[model samples]
Target: MTRTQAPRSSPSRTSPSHLLPTEEPLALLRPDGTPVEGSPLVMPADDVLVELYRRMVVGRRFDTQATALTRQGRLAVYPSSRGQEACEIAPVLALRPDDWLFPTYRDSVALVSRGIDPAQTLTLLQGGWHLGYDPYEHRVGPQCTPLATNTLHAVGFAHAARLKGEDTAALVLLGDGATSEGDTHEALNFAGVWQAPVVFLVQNNGYAISVPLDKQTAAPTLAHKGIGYGVPSVLVDGNDAAAVYAVVRDALRTGGPTLIEALTYRIEAHTNADDATRYRTSDEVAAWLARDPVDRLSAYLTARGLLDERTKDDVAREAETFAAAVRAALNVDVEPDPADLFEHVYATMPAHLRAQAEFLREESA
Candidate 1:
């Protein structure tokens, strides 16, 4: 049998296979829109696939719209997750509404897939509010700009939920560069020690803001890093939406901490401010573009008779409307409130901060 062929029967299977990720990234669908024979993983239902495709289409449109917003000065800066739609949308669909999501600045598309308002998702990058949405309301923490810090937060929440006898899980999204952070080590250690119901989704999009993975770490794959902490890790083809959903669903079902490294590529620059052409070649980008998650799934579904040209057009129209709505929502003229920064810092304003607030108010006046 293949290394990943065994079904996950128990969470406490004391076997090496359970402790280590597959040697190769797991994939359910190939680029040519066909399933891999003997993959052991169950394919999602046609209805689920259709929903996933819709969300992916909309999420990607929202991503590109945010990019355009940056160009139009509607946002201060924007990070694009163009080629990583499967990694973004699938994981969100894998979570229960009660489960928490700890995301980074690059996971705005995931937030959109989670039913978050597009305007609210960009609040931090808008250079306005601390966070446009309340964490408790959405069961999602504020998006961390720093690397791997949010992983620790996920562990803490998961571990505490376990102690309280709550059947809860936390899913945290990290970039390939975040694997090098000290908190990544700490988070994995704590999760393994406590057996916290947390899943780490590391989107390994090749480069970490110009530093290639080769330059970052010597590990075979970022998923392998979990083995050191006694956490089970798996690598998945990030462009295969079906594979992402199946793998993540299996991990969550085991009811413990797991790490997943998704093999994808960042098609756009690090952010709107950076130039991607300097660090990467067009040929590489074109190769990944041809393997786009959205297109691959659309093709597979259409071939299977689960989707039609009409449905595809309808989904695209919906995505366009969603993008247009976000555009309208953000196309507003508003002045920043100088006092707002000081308001959330303290329950009762500290004397020093009070003075600072007053000074800023007077200066503005």
Candidate 2:
């Protein structure tokens, strides 16, 4: 999860007892679009911010397109990232080119930001011959659908990198719900013990499928759990990309494991197959909408004169073009050969598997 810096609360007008209570979370921009003191936060260069914005726009568009494509039967079910693009993009862009990313099944946005082709995402969803490239070769591990299992793999990768004297780090993205899994706890322990160079990013979207966070844990903040394991942790406003970037950057740069619990809300259903309306309220959605990440960033940029109507229009058009291209690419059906599944299972198939493969072929005929 990324660090979002909210406006600083000051001690009263000039008196010792006039101080206001500090908001638990930090945010450089408030919900109303006011620019709080932007300094002291790890301020990214303008180019980096623009690049981050581009990635967010592209990711949002890709998610929208994929959702539509699934409805049209062009692919298997898609888990929409609707309203959570910044939650995906900021930390991803904060990484060095050589850094690795371990993403969850729903984190296509992070993969896209990492330079994975849009077609590859569709291919994975479609279950085509190529669910895409070898992730290790791409420096982004395979998408982990088994909840928190990938966090262990990330720790292992970071451990290996340390052994090899590699300077690169790993960032593992998992949902807030994943924190409840035993694998997540074990991974945190290993990462702490080994002092692994990885960042456990928990995108706290307030729900674990239909289960709300309250039912998932009694901890006041997920970040606090890291303390028990001896790993430093911080909770941030997940929607503020700038804050997210700064916090994540500091964590990654300092070495060892850091847990960033990004506070956010998932506005849509867990996936195309789930109905959020069944378990949540429209009022809750409306309330989160008021703190939408994109709107907040846009408002900040506009106030600073960095984003104008023309620039906004251009960004929207560019995103639409990318979405159209993804739609067009998914239309091409690439069938996987039936024998291909067995081809890559082992370096050399044991006699039993060899015989089984033949048996399968004959049985199919």
Candidate 3:
């Protein structure tokens, strides 16, 4: 997640409320497109806000295109971030070029916002022979499908950067359900002990596949769990794009590990295969639609005179162009060679496997 920046609050609105999340989710704008009143929330500069909005538009378009590919059998599986666009875009925009991002399977949109090619970002889901894009090229790790495991990798990578005397930070995106995993616990512990620069952004999108947040945990909120590991935590309305961006920017500037739980909803089915309607009601989805991230930002920007009809039209046109290109790219088949299966298996290939590769090579030849 990259482009978000906004403000926060809690019991100690004036006090140094480190480690305490605001009573309510932090937000800079209301659903009706008005800025929240009487809060010290820092609004992002107009330019940054506009950029955030644009990337989100392009990101969502890319997301829909990816989901469409699944229905066309061009992809194996796709977890749609249809309603979680704020969590998908912000925070990555706050990063410096030297920073690293450890994303989850649900974060193809985030990867695109980070300037990754859309086709390369979907290569894994397309069953490509490689990771599709070079991880070094964008400093993004392979998309981790296993829940919460990526957090540990982020901690390790950030700690190593610290050891090497580099000012690098790692932002790891996890779902609400991932907080229960032991890997999240260990990652927090290690990050706290080493004071690593790692920001854990939990997109609490209401469900972990079929399980709702209530069934997932009894903790007051996911952010509170950070206190146990001595990591500072904050809660924000994930739908408020500006607020999300502000909180993430401050957390990174705070100079240590932070955990953020952004309250959002997963509008689509868990994937191209899961049936979301079975677990959630249409009314529930409708309510969230009123608070949609993209709409919230667009409305707020328009009211402030920062966004005009022309700008909106231009953004939409650009998004459509991007989507068309992605569609065209995926329309072509990318065939993988059989011998590639053994290529990255080991640095020093064993004799038996070496014979197998040779046999396959001979067969192909």
Candidate-wise lDDT, in order: 0.90, 0.82, 0.90
**Candidate 3 global CA lDDT score:** 0.90
- Tens-place lDDT per residue, model 2, 107-151, is 888888787888885567776655585686668888887999999
Give the C-alpha lDDT of model 2.
0.82
Question: Model 3 segments beyond 4 Å from truth?
Answer: 1-17
Please list all clashing residue pairs in model 2, or write none if there are none. 1-201, 2-244, 3-243, 3-244, 5-26, 5-27, 5-28, 6-26, 6-27, 6-28
* Candidate 3 accuracy as TM-score: 0.94
Worst 10 residues of 2 by lDDT: 13-22
Checking candidate 1 for backbone clashes, the offending pairs are: none
Candidate with better TM-score, 1 vs 3 = 3
Model 3 per-residue lDDT tens digits across residues 1-365: 34585544443433335777888888899987789986566988999999999999999989888998899998999999988998988888887788899999999999999889989999888877679889899999999989999999999999999999988889999999898899999999999888899999999998889999899899899999888787889999899888888988887776689999999988889998898888989999999999899999999899889999999999999999999999999999766778888988799999999999999999999
Tell me the spans in candidate 2 whose CA falls farther than 4 Å from its real position. Answer: 1-23, 38-40, 129-131, 352-365
RMSD of each: 6.6, 9.2, 7.9
Candidate number achieving the greatest TM-score relative to the actual structure: 3
